[model samples]
Target: MTSDGVTTSRVVADVARELEIELPTLSSRMASSFLNQIPALQGDDAVTQLVVASTSSNLSTVIDVLQHGIPLHQISVPAAAAAHARRFAQRELPVEALLRAYRLGESQFVQWCLRLLAARSLDAAELLAAVQEITSVAARYIDQVCEHLVDIYETERRLWGQRADAARAASVRTVLGDETLDVGTAEAMIGARLRGWHVAAVAWLQSDPSDAARRVESAAQLLTEAYGRSPLTVLADDHTLWAWVSGTSRPRLDEQVLDRALVSHPDLHLALGDPGPDLAGFRSSHREALKAKAVAQMSGGTTARLTRFATVSISALLLDRLDEVRTWVGRTLGDLARDDEAMAKLRDTVRIFLQTGGSFTDAAARLHLHKNTVHYRVRKAEEIRGRPLGDGRLDVEVALVICRQLGGGVLMR
Candidate 1:
C-alpha cells in the first residue's frame, strides 16, 4: 500500500511506464534490494513500500510518483540523470551542506565526548584506540576534511574565549563606574533601599601586588556579604591596590571587615583612609588612602593604620616642613635664650591654642595644664618670639601650621 491509500503496485507501474521500463519484475527486484540494505524499510508499511517500488525507476519518474504524497519541490533530483541516457548516475552533494551539518552537530558531539571522558566509564587507552580505528575509515573518504574540522574547532574555541573576555571587561567597567548602584541618585536611593545609612572607608596595599589584588577581591566580597551590597571598589595599579568599603558605621567596618581582612597577613600592611558619604567619596577615599600609606611609613607602624584628613592637626602640617620652620623660628626669635625644650613647649602650646579656636582655657585643658600656668607660658612665648600674644590668632595659626609641617620635635609633646 502507498502512504495515502494509493497502491504501491500502481505507483511502481506508473513510474516504470514513465521511464519506459518493465514494471512488476523491476519493482520486485528493487524492493528486495532496498529491504536487504535498509532493514528498517523491510516492513510492509506504506512509506517504505512506496520507496521500494520506485527505486529502479528513473529519478524524475520516481519523484513525480512520490510528489502525490510528498512535496516534489522538497525532493532533491540527481543532475547526472539528465546527462546519462543508459545508466543512472548519482548527483554530487554541495560542500556547504556537509559543512553546515557538521557545524551544527560538532559542539554537541564534543560535549558528549568530554562528558564520557569525565565519567571514567570508558578506558582511556581503549577510547584512543577506538578513535584511531574510526579515523582510518574517515581517512579513506577525505584526508583534508579532518584537518579542516580541527581548525574550525580551534577557531570557534578562540572566538568564544574572546567573547568571554569582552564580557568580563564590560563588567569591570560597570563596577568601577558604580553604575549598578545608580550613583547619580545614590544618596536618596541607597537610603531608601539599604537597611541603614552607609559609611565608607578606603584601604590600600603598597606591598605585594598579587596579595593586594587578592585582598581587594576578598574585601569586596566580605563587604558585600556583611552589608548586603558591594560598597567596595578595587583599583589596582602596578604596585598597589586601593579598596573602599561603605556601610552603616565605622566600628562595624573596622571590627568586622577591614580588621578581619588583615588578620591573616602579618607582613602585609594597609593604610585605611577616612570614611566618606557615598559613591562620590570613592575618589577622596582613594586619595586619602595614599596619604595614609605615607603617614604609616613615616610613623613606622607595624599593623594597618587609619588616618583621617579631618583630624590632621595644624602641627602635623607644620611638622611636614620642619627644617624651614625651625630656621624661621630661630631667625625670628634669635635674641631669646635658646632652650630647645622650652621652644618646643611654646610651639605645642601655640598649636593647641590656635587649633582650639584661640581659647586659652580649651588649649590648657588639652595640654593638661592649670589655667594660670598656661597664661604664664603664653607670656614667656610672646617674650621669646618678640611679638605680643594678644589678638594674634592668624599669626599664631600660621606659625603653628608651619611648625607642624616642619616635623621638628618642637611639637612632639
Candidate 2:
C-alpha cells in the first residue's frame, strides 16, 4: 500500500491497464522483431498479416490475464496462436523459431513493464515488487502457452509429414509406372527436373531397421553426394529409398568414397544404374538400378555394398533363372568354375587373359602377377575345361564374369 499514496494492488492494476492500451504497439514491435530474426516467418503479404494477427492476439491475451485475475489452468491458447503454430508445422518451419519468438517476446514485454514502472512515482522496493509480479505473470503465461503450442506443432508436423510423404510416393510411382507420362507434367509432379542425365539409385539398410527412414535416406544422399545438389528421393518402403540425381553430365561413383561411407553408415547397401538422358532415360535408368539391386539382394550381401548395373547386367538378366545360369556356368567354364580358392585364382587369371585378347603381359598387370604366372594359370584353366582357349572364348569370358559377379550363386560348389 505505498506507491504515490496508491495501494500496491491498485498501482499494479493501474499499470496493467496502461499496458493493455499499449498492446497493439507492443504486438507490432514484437512481430517486427520476429520477422527480422526468423527468416522463415518473413513470407508473402498474407503470411505477414497472419503474423500480425497472431502476435496481436497473443499480446492482448497476456495483457487481459495481467489486468484481470485469471487462473492459468482455465486458459487455453488463443485461436490465432494455434493457427500460427499449425501453419509453421504445415509449412515445415522449425518449432525452434516459434520458441525463439516466445523468448524474445517475453524479454521485451518484461522490459516494457519495467520502463512504465520506473516512470511511476514509486520507491525502489515498490518498483521491484511490481516488476517482479508483472514479469512472473507474463513469463508464466508465455511458458504455458508455448508448452501447449509445442504439443500442437509437433502433432501437426507429424501428420503433415506423413501426408507429404504419401503424396510424394504416389507421384514417384506414377512416374515409374507405364502410364504414358508427359515429361513436363511428370517432372512437375515429382518436383524435380527431368532434363539432363539421370543416375538412379536404390538404397537399403541391412540391420538397425528401426531407423530405416533416416538411415536409408542418408544412404541415398551419401551415394549421390557428388551431384552437388540434393537428389529426388522417395521412400519406396520402410527400409528402402529410391533416388535420382540429374546434372549436366553423368556422375562417376567414387569406389573409395562409397566404401568409406559404408563403414560410416553401418550395414548400408546401395545399387546404382547407368546414367541415361531425358524422361525415357529416367525410367530405363531406374529399371537398370532395380536389376542391379536384385542381383545384390540375391547374393545376400556377399557382393560389394555398392553394386553397379554396368558390371552386373548379365547377372541381373539371369537372376530369375539362377539354376539355369548355374548349369550354364558349370558347362561353359567346366572345372574352372569350381568354388575353390585355387580354381578361383586360375579362373580369374584366365578370364583376364582372354579379356585382354590373349595378352599375358596385360593379364599379368591386371592380376598383379608375372606374365609367366598368367601363362601358367591360363594353361591350367584350359586343362581343367578340357578345351583350347579359342574353343569357346566368348562363352568362357561371359561365364567367368557371371561367376565373379554372382560368386557362389552360379559357381559349382
Candidate 3:
C-alpha cells in the first residue's frame, strides 16, 4: 500500500517497469500466440510486423492501468491497437476472431504477472493483494479496450463498405432491392442483360488484396465464366465480389469441375444461385446466392468453400429464421440434437434409413454399414429421440437436413 494516495502498491509499480522492459519479448510471444490460435489473423510480412506493434501497445496499456490504478472510463485504446483493429475491419476479417485474440492475450499477460510475483519474498496477504490487482486490472483493461475496438471496427467497416466502387454497388443494390423496376432500365445501369436465364454468384477472399478492384473482379469472373461470357461483376466490399452470369439457355453446372478449378485458388469462396429466367430471375437468383453465402458464413467450414444453392437450399431459406430453427431443431431431435461426431453419424444413418423407405439394406449400402449396424443405429437414434421414428418422420427428416447443412449453427449451443 502507498501512503502517497495512488491506490497502487510499489510492488505493482516495479512489476509494471519490468513488463515495460520486457515489452518487446512479451509482445512478440503474444503476437505469435494470436496468429497460432487464429491463422486468419496473419497477413503478409508487413501486416505481421504491424500485429506485433499492436500487441506491444495493448500489453503496455494494461501495464499502465495496473501501475497507475487507472479508472476504467479514463482508459483509452492505444493508437496502434485502434489502427490495427480498423485494418482488420477493413479486411473484413471475422470480428469474433479479433475479439478472441484479446482474451487470449489477457490470459498470457496474467500468467506472466503471476509467475513474476510468485518469485517475490512477500507475505501471503501481500502476494494475494498483488495477484488480485494484476488479474483484475488485466481483465478489466481487456474488456474496456475490446468494447472500444468493436466500435472502431464497426465504424470503419461501414465506411469501407460505402467507399467501394460506390456507383456500381448502388446500381446492383438498387436492382436487388427492388422487383418492380423496369428490366431495360436496370440492364442499362448494370450494363448486363436481364432478358435471359441468369445464374447469380458471390465470391470472396479472406486475405487482403494487393489490387482490390482487379482482384475482386477476377474472383467474380472465375465463378461466373463457366456459365456465361461478359458477366456483370460488382465489388461488394474490400473482401467480397458479386456477379450475375446470363445466357439464352440454362447452363449445366458440374460440381466436380468447379471443385477441381477451386483447388488452385485456395482463398476464393464461391456461392451460386440456381438458374432463373427474366428480370425476376435476376433478382431472385441473387437472393438465393446470398442465402447460400449466409449458410457458408455460419458454417465457416473450408469444405463448404464452394456452396451451391441447390445443395443447401433448405437451410438457406431458413437462415433468416435460425433462432426459430434452433429451437425447433432442439425440440424435434431431443437428445438426438446433441452436437458430436457419434450423434452426427447416427443422425446421418437415420436420415438415410428414412430416405430409403426404411430399407436397412439400401441404407447400409449408402452408409457402407452392415444392415444389422444400420438397424442398430436407427434403434439407437429412436431411443435418443425418446420415441419411435414412425410419427413426425417428415419433421425428423427436415431437422436432420438442417443439422447436416448448418453444422453447429443450429445445434444446441
- Top of the candidates by TM-score: 3
Model 1's TM-score against the true structure: 0.34
Writing each residue's lDDT as its tens digit, candidate 1 over 189-209 gives: 323222233344344444444
Task: Rate residue 174 of model 1 by lDDT.
Answer: 45
Provide the TM-score for each candidate, comma-separated: 0.34, 0.55, 0.63
Q: RMSD of each candidate?
A: 34.4, 23.1, 10.1
Model 3: residues >4 Å from true position, as ranges? Answer: 1-166, 178-180, 206-216, 300-303
What local lDDT does model 2 show for residue 58? Answer: 84
Candidate 2 residue spans exceeding 4 A from truth: 1-164, 248-263, 299-301, 359-362, 368-375
lDDT for 23 in candidate 2 is: 76
Which pairs of residues collide in candidate 2? none
State the lDDT at 141 in candidate 3. 83
The digit string of per-residue lDDT tens for model 3 on 333-387 reads: 9989888888888989999999999999999999998999999999999999999
lDDT of each: 0.44, 0.79, 0.79
How much RMSD separates candidate 2 from the native structure? 23.1
How far does residue 59 in candidate 3 sit from its true spot (Å)? 14
Deviation in Å, model 2, residue 167 alpha carbon: 1.9
